[model samples]
Target: MRKWGPLVAVCLGTFMLLLDVTIVIVALPDIAGELGASLTGLQWVIDVYALVLAALLLGAGAAADVLGRRRVYAAGTALFTLASVGCGLAPGTGALVAMRGVQGLGAAAMFATTLSLLGAAYRGRDRSFALGMWGAVSGAAAALGPVLGGVLTQGLGWEWIFFMNVPVGAVAIWLTLNAVAPDGARGTRRLDLAGAAAFALFAGATTYAAVRAGEEGWTSGRTLAVFGVAAVALVLFGRAERRAVDPLLDLSLLRRGAFVTVLVAGLAYNAAAFGVMPYVSVWLQTVLGLSPVRAGLALLPLAAVSFVVAAAGGRLLHGAQARFVLGGGLLLIGGGTLGQAVLDADSGWASLSAGLAVSGVGVGLVSPALGGAALASVPARHSGMAGGAVNTFRQLGFALGIAVFGTVATSRMTDVLHDGGAARELAGGGAAALRGTVPDEVLRTAFASGLDGALTAAGVLGLVGGLAALAWVRSPGPEAETEAKAESERDRGDGVPAVGAGAPASPGGA
Candidate 1:
């Protein structure tokens, strides 16, 4: 019980953070309607959270190593809880977007430390099992997000979606404070302020550019300027890290093919899964005219299949080579996404369901195996950094996916509408304008064309990721496994206390 306490606390926090990623997606239309926000405003609401999270993750991980894992984790929970309240109470689109950024800050801190804390709490085969469980929680939470969001948004209101996080986060904070152990010693590493700033700018600028390009033309001055800024920042960030005493990101890790492969795999998996999800949700509601609850229920097969497959994949990680598992997973995602691309105006729920189930299984297999493999490839001491690296890429991939694929869908839709002689209607209003003014047949056909383009691009990305995994990822060698067992035995021999054993447990040993 003591050993598993920290895992539960961390998982709770992880569940809340990831749940937010997908939960808001289903509620976007409601938010837009109430706030009178444009498509750009809605995109920012989603993008800002991921953008902030990706930018700050590396710095947060370093902070965890220097400050304290439990301390950082608890602070994050408190901040996330507070931010959720603000989100629920927000009066306008801008306010909600700003608050979501704050929420991302808290999420970054919590995500940066959770895997490291888990690594510290368990060792050897126990470690593998614990991580598998952690992976399952992640898959399940993401899967549940849309359904839960639909239920809350439909029954209570969109505000309740954010409000619900408040009580759950409060409990997570309490559990973290009582159940997690303190770091034995803090490292005296210098925080790379310059490197952190540069990296943040680079990521933020790139995301801004992508989003702006979708709204304006790709060659617009604002988009080009931001892209230029991003390029400069990326170069500066590399230089700063190379010279820093204790860099936030270690460039040396990139030289390892396995590490780079896993990072790429993370990016690809998220690009196809998280990136494509928002549009799909919107299509269900806006195009098919399903209510929020029905749309959420319709997504059930994806979540259910993902949850089951992820658990199985985690168990398989103990013996299977990561390359095979990851590669196979990516292939499934590619095939699934390609299947979705075949949808036309005549397609129904059955077509969507079949594709979603395939993608879910792919995500399930890749999610845990990718994280576990990335962490294993790195030295134990740098576990926090490794986790951050993997997540950073995943978030960036998500941002890019949203930006690029969104552009494809929107542009394609516009082109279709224009070719059909509805350019004036589109110009008067965006998708909303089409709802009442345009003919149903015209609207459906245009939307389907846009979806086909987006899904095809996503499928190509997935296939590329699969190829990278097969080429670069490898399983742990025999010596590595032996060393891991030896380390576990040594920790036991030294009588290192299990998590929460030295500290007072929460009430009822939560």
Candidate 2:
């Protein structure tokens, strides 16, 4: 029990935080219906958690290093539990979105610490075994989220999805306090509070602009104003990074072509892959009349194939170059997303299976390789930054993708329907609610058209990512590689964390 206790505790927090990413998908209709949420509100509910999680991860990771990993992990679990209860009891769309953002804050803290906690707890073979187990558990989140959410929503109501966490979090908190080791010594790195704040402001502003653009025209005064804020925040973030003693993002890493390519790949891989699933969940329930369980099951092909392909890739392609693997995977993701763009009014849910499976291959191929690829591209001293940057971009990709795709979908639906006002309602899983007033056939056509647009947008992003990767990314020369390994060992001896000094999360997703 002593030996395995830390692994179990860390996994509990990891699974809950990641599961909430997609678990909210299957319950969107219920949430929209019960809360009377607008399309924008619905988008906020989904995107805010991801946005905050991405923004805070780097900052939170540094905090864990300073304040102690177990200490931060325990506080995060407690906060997440309380916030989950808040979400379950939220009285309206606004309250729910606010609580979900709090959930993200808690999630970021927990995520930032989990792997580091493992690194501190285990050694040698046990470290390898523990990390492998942790990765396996993390992979299960993307596969099981929708299915578990479905069972909870249909059988127990949507609230149980959040409510279910209370017991698990309580147990995790207990274990973290009792079983995990104390910090050995505090590090010298000071918190880059300026960098963290500026980055958060930038991310939040940009996402708000994307969401608002879907409502007010892109050229509208309100939309343009928010965009102006985003631009300013981005500039501030850059300045802060430049001035920091220990920056959240190291600017020097951006000079390397391989490192830059990996960052782009992280953004494209997540945005193109999992960003469109929430809308699919909507169409399944509101348009197709499938039960939540059935809707979740329909999405299972992608997750299942991803799991199998990832396991196979790890074994068979262990020695393969990351460029070919990641590039090829992204190409497959593009192909799969484009294939699904064929959906029409007459198409059924089964039309998504082949495309989902293809994208799954891409997801599996790219996910496990991300950290290794990032680590190899930069100097050993920058490895921790690379790891955290990969996750930041990946989550940022999801948030931005959701915002952009939602806009594309609503715009396309408005085009098809020729009624701008109805587009928002229809996009927010309101088809069943609007049925008697609007013709069912029209609703179906508009929804299909909107989905086609969103999928096409995601597909194009994927293709660009693939081609960029193929053209530019390269493995280091033998000399550089050897030097990096030596430096990495020295860093270890000096008690520096190899990856995620700020953070690296499990990369698997919807």
Candidate 3:
């Protein structure tokens, strides 16, 4: 237990970072009302936080390698805590939004260094368990956010949501300094400032286009311009990464099977989770008319099941084949999400909870398994890079999932409402009422049809993701079993740096 204290602190930091993503959604109306934010401004409040975090992930990882992980981690905690206070105290929505973005920046720094620090602190079985625990805790945090946010928003105030982080973050920072060693890696690598800037701009533009496409329509000049800029910037960023000596991200890592597969899985997992959850919340509150607190409480089954399954999954890892475990998990997730397509006004909490439970179980199974697989594929020396790469893909997946899923949900809702005779009625009292408290009967009729369609679509996408993984990730038992036999007869090769021999000096692998 003592040996794992630092790991727990890092996991706590990770949990806090992920929790902020969805916690704010449950309080969106409150924030908007207090700050009088426009719809576009409200979108920015959410998207900007994700955008900044995604953009800085790779750069921050490299920074930790140079600056010393403990120093960077402590500074990140301080920045994040300070920003949270700023968010809580902000007089207006714009101020809160800006502070949230600052919080994201701090989160990026901490996220990049966390796993690397854990790797340094634990070894063998203990290290694997720590990584698995981290993954489990992160997922649970995402699931728990709405409940915690709703409780705070309803019982205390929205400001308490941000303020809640202060104590938790302080504890984490304190533990980080005293329990963890100074640096995870020794290096004199230069920061890829230009690459970082370009990547940030490109990611922001692309994500902006994806998110706004539903609201602004595909043909809107602003949306088109965002996509265009994103395209150009992405191309330029790729070129810059290829040419840089020490790039913020090592694109070459893309060639490895384990790394690439896990990255893909990471993307798919986020796409499913982000795409599905928002709609579920809407179904419960907007269609079913549950209060925010009630809606939040509805998620407890998923939370409880996910926590238990994730805990069990770590034990399964020692005996199971990675591919089999991961593929099966994805399949379950797909099955559960698809089941949500059956949700309607009449469906009770049992049905909803069951679907969420299945998805949660699936998520629990695959999340950490993929991370461990990715790290194992590389030599121990490259664990930091491998871990960072995995996280980058996960964040990118999250951004994409939210963007694409949000587009689908919004478009579907608009279409259904426009076609129905009650469209104007919905646009009037329903919209107005929806801006505040949602009543059950009103929510039931409003979301009954729309929720089914959205969940069905999300489930299909999830199932497709699962099937794709199944096809690509072979059954691990036979191949791995055979390899085990061959290994005893052969000498394990010495570690060779993945960087090719005689490769000329390029500027960034910092």
Q: Which of the predicted structures, 2 or 3, would earn the higher TM-score when compared with the native? A: 2
- For the record, the alpha-carbon RMSD of candidate 2 to the native fold, in angstroms, is 2.0
Output the number of the lDDT-best candidate.
2
Error of 3 at 122 (Å): 2.2
TM-score of 3: 0.85
Using lDDT as the measure, what is the rank order of every candidate, best first?
A: 2, 1, 3
Q: Which stretches in model 1 have alpha-carbon errors above 4 Å?
A: 1-3, 123-126, 376-383, 419-432, 478-510
lDDT of 2: 0.83
The C-alpha lDDT values of all candidates are 0.76, 0.83, 0.67
**Model 1 per-residue lDDT tens digits across residues 1-510:** 577888788888988998887788788778877887676677777888888888998888777766777898899889998999999999999999999999999988887777667767776788667667788888777777899999999998999999998888987888787777766756566778899899999999998899778777799999999999999999999999899988876788778888888888888988887687777777777777778898888888878898898777655556677788889889898888888897778766566788888988888888777755675665543444666677788878887888888888878877867742243223212456566766877777777787788899999999999988988887767776676556556444322211111110000000
lDDT of 3 by residue, 1-510 (tens): 468778878887888988887777666656655786544555566667767887888788777666776787789888999999999999987798899889989988887777656656766688567767776787677667888888998899889999999999999988887787555335667777777888888988888898677567788999999999998888888888888877865677667666577667766766675555655664555455576788788877666776677777776656675666766777777778777666555786567777888887877776666655554444444445666666666667666666666556555555654533232223212445443554445445455555566566666666766666665554334554455335322312211111111110100010
